[model samples]
Target: MSTTWSAPGRVTLIGDHTDYNAGLSLPFGLDRRTSVTVRRADEPILRVRSDSPGAGPVSVPARVLELPEPPAVDGWAAYPIGMAWALAQAVPGAIGPFEATVTSDVPVGIGVSSSAALEMAVGTALAELFGLDLGPAELAAAGQRAENVAVGAPTGILDQTAVMFARRDHGVLIDFADLARRAVPLGLAAAGLGVLIIDSGTRHEHGTGGYGQRRAECAEATSVLGLTSLRELGVDDLDRVRPRLAPNVFRRVRHVVTENARTARVTELLDAGRAAEIGDLLTASHASMRDDFENSVPAIDAAVAAAVDAGALGARLFGGGFGGACLALVPTDRAEQLAAAITAGVVAGGHPDPVIRLAAAADGPRREPDPG
Candidate 1:
């Protein structure tokens, strides 16, 4: 029998580093996604293949049911392998002989959670293949476990959750503290606007050193301030603790505190149908990420500035932005213009031409592709 499953990519409209700190995040699913096809096998072996260029197939014995001490490869296969390890942990005898063909339109290394999409796709496929009664949240958590523990990446739950539960034409407002979520309506089209993701195509490794360093730094700051996580700190708390932190930790904490507030404000604007105000928040969030969080690279900053100059409502480097993508909120009528501007700017900044596309707010993981 043929089993086909897909998982959507994610964009964090606001609240970046706060997820692991137990703060709220607002993210939306993108039209871009990764799909996986699988079938049961007679032998007790797990095999995976990717259609993407330079990626090859891999096979592992089912009898070897544990995660690699350190993952065997640093690329696409790590996701599926991590998922299998996670499933084996959750459900004894759940991972068995199977073969999977993976394919995705979600651009890799673009800070769009392409890796999570792949992991979720595989996790869902295995769940279906084995008749496991996994709920959306459970599936997301499983995928996240694979990333965080198995793959050793310190990522928050936002990417997996957004891919699993976001609804079309809306953003998911996630209370990271409680895992409570509400799909906030966005009227971009109704307001004659579009969301543009400009892929810088610069791949950075979240698992390779940088991500772990940042996580450790954030954790150290929280510990020093006597808070449970960075999320517990408010503006006043930041002011009170600012003098004690190193200059860099102070900046990082500043971004997290202010970014959390910005997410709440953006949610309000979305609920009130004030589409025009979104750009301002987007720009502010980008500035905070760039200056305070120290995430933005020169290429990312250039793309954001170019999009705004080309009449985007607001633009910012999105995701874990050392190198990845930038997003722009533009009038739908001017989407092409904004996209072109961002593309040209990236090229002018000595990078390759960026991939530009219009992304609608899309639903999270579903059994069937969204109707229309």
Candidate 2:
């Protein structure tokens, strides 16, 4: 039997990089999605193909899927292969010899968690095809393992969990401390507000790059603070901890501490249906990322300023730092005008014109009806 599964990409509104610190984060699944179709194979091999441009097909031996190490495959194929490997470890049997095809509308390289979307899609399809009864949380954990172990990116569970537990018309408040999630009412549509994303087109990989460096720095901060995780340090404790850390390390700690607090405040605003008021908090979060966390790029920073100039209530750089996309909260009626203004402003600043789109909160991953 053949089956299809799909997962949505996610956008973090606040609390970037706080996931590994065991702090809080606010994220929502976007309308964009990645899908996978899987069917049993006659041969004992897993064959994977992608509709992405320039991506070639890959084949892996099903026998090696149970191994602890990731397969030798690289590029986009690693994500699916990693998922299979991860699922094999999680489930109590050998993984499938199946043929799978992948396609996505989720923009790549713009910090929308496209990788997580792909991973979840693959995981869901494999689970169903193999008759493995896995819950959403279990699937999310498998996806995280796929990224962290098989894919070699030291990422937190936020991306996987965000895309799995997200609810339509709501934002998810994830406490990395306990892996607890609460749905916050975004009410964006009810409030006449919408989310606008501007893709900076600058790409970043989570695998052993500056992303790893930041994670290492956070670990160092945790060690210096004598805490298990940075979540143990609240804003009140910052003054005492500041004297113990170096300048840069202290800034990183400060970002996590303040960001956790900001996430809580945003949650309160969202709970009260005050989505519009959370705009300032979004801008503040961007400032913290730019000045404290040191993750914002010049193009993203310029685009954010332009978005505000174009009447966005608040704007901030989205995803892990270095390069990605910027998000703005704007009036729904003015979305087109704001997008045009932000694009024009970015281009005028000598940066490549960004791709802008309006997105709404969307449901999480699930089995999809056959497109046929």
Candidate 3:
């Protein structure tokens, strides 16, 4: 028998670079997802194939899973292979050679966190196939390890945690200081509010130097501030530290500090059923990313401006930034109209035609019922 599993991509509604600094983040699982099908292989080799265009089949000795990282595998296949290594580490002897087919509607490199979705899908399949008793958070950690160690991307737990702990009609509010997660009721659909994701058609990879440089700057700031992480200070502490940090480092530090507060406020607003009031905070978060964090790209900025001008309640660039998707909160009735306006506005600004998706809070990862 074969098991098919899937995990949802995530949208970091607010709080971007703050995760690694042990700050707060609020993310919702997107309806877009990645799925994996797994069954035992006849040989002692881990085989893989993907339906994504231009991806080729990869095969490697199953014993490589025992290593800290699989050096033989690279590219998209490394995500699942790395996940298998992580799962094995969590529960020794729980994984073996398997052949899997991967598929997804989760667009890659557009900031929806398709990598986490892919990892979680493969992790869920391995756990079920081997009967491992891991919970959502544990699985999430393993996914993070896979990315950080196996895939070599220095990402925080936000993507994996958001993908695994997500709830329908709710967003996951995570405190990286302690990895505590609270389910905040989105109440968007009930309030006739919808989040429109406009793909700026500009791609970015977390493994790239730009992302690493941002992380490095945050670390330097943290060391200079004499704190372990930026979470050690609150917004009130920013003024006291500003004079000590370089202008650039200070801005980076400022973004993480203020973003945490914004994330907390948005969580409170959503918890109190004030989802409509979050537009200003979303826009503010974007401004912080653009000016302080220096993560927003010109195309994404154009898309965000168009979204706001087209009557979006509030709009901002979502994901790891640099270049990715922009999220705009809009009335459910006007979602398509807003999308059209964003498209026109983006083209007028001389950027590529953007891909627009209408999304809502969605369920987390799970094993799919066998279709056989």
Candidate 4:
């Protein structure tokens, strides 16, 4: 018998790179998702097939007790394999051999957490097949463990929790300090605002690049400031501690502290239905990431400029930086024009033409009960 499940991808409305620092972030699941279909068998072999953009197919033994001491494989199949491995770790010996097919409309490597969407999709299938009884938070944690331990990506809980907990027409305000999530209302369409996601088309791999390094710098700043995390500092406190930190560490801490406040403001404004007022906050966020965090590339800046010039109310570089995508708050009427201008500008600036995706807030991970 086969069980099918799907999980949506995420877009960070505000708050960038603050998750690992145990700070605040606001994200929403977008309309795109990855779907997985799984069938359990008696054999010891596990097979994974996928149409996930760049991943090929793979097969491995479903041996929970004999998992490789080190993570052995990390291709397209790593996501599902890690899903089964997560189930194995959570409930010993309950994992069974399974065959699964994965497909996604979520663009890979665009900072949309395509990997997390894939993991949660497969994890939900495994949960149903084995009767694991995982809750929303448990499911998110399990997927994060799989991504971190098995996939070797040092990401925090933002992407996984956003995909699992976000809801329709809302942004999930996540406090990573304790994994608490609250779905805040976002009246974008009612307010005549549109979310524009412009893919910079520059590929970034979090594990091998500067993402981990930036995370480490934040930790260093926390150590020097005698705080457990950068979350402890507010925007006012940035000046008090600025002299004590090194230039780079101070900049990193500044970004996190300010971004956390921006998240709170965005949540407040979103709840109040003041969607247009949050545009400057979005642009400020991009500047912090660009100037303070030093993660934005030329293509990212170009996208933001073109988006704003084409009548976007506010545009910022989105994702974990080093080249991913940009988010713009635009008039619903100007969305197509914004897309066209951004594309032309990027290509004219000698960068690859960017693909623009218009997204609305979507519900979190969902599973269908087995009919058999």
Between candidates 1 and 2, the one scoring higher on lDDT is 2
For 332-372, candidate 2 gives per-residue lDDT tens digits of 99999999999899989999989888998999987889868
User: Candidate 4's C-alpha lDDT?
Assistant: 0.86
Q: Model 1: per-residue lDDT, tens digit, 277-353? A: 88888899999988888888887888888888778888887776678988888888878877887888778888788
List model 4 lDDT by residue over 1-372, tens digit each.
Answer: 799899999999998899999899999998998888899867888888887456666777666425644246767676678868877877777778888988789988889889889988988888888888788788888788888888888889899899988799999999988878898999998999889999988988887779988998999998988998888888899889999989999999999989999989989998898998998899999999999999999998999988877778898877788988989999888788889988998888889989897899998878755545
Candidate no. 1 TM-score: 0.95
Enumerate clash totals for all models, in the order shown.
2, 0, 1, 0
Model 4, position 124, has a per-residue lDDT of 82
lDDT at residue 314 of model 4 (Cα atoms): 91
> Candidate 4, after superposition: displacement of residue 113 in Å?
0.5
Higher-scoring candidate on TM-score, 3 or 4: 3
Q: How accurate locally is residue 314 in candidate 1, as Cα lDDT from 0 to 100? A: 89
lDDT, model 3: 0.90
In model 1, which runs have C-alpha deviations exceeding 4 angstroms?
A: 66-74, 368-372
| RMSD to true structure for each model, in Å | 2.5, 1.0, 1.1, 1.8
- Candidate 4 residue spans exceeding 4 A from truth: 64-71, 368-372
Q: Per-candidate TM vs. native?
A: 0.95, 0.98, 0.98, 0.96
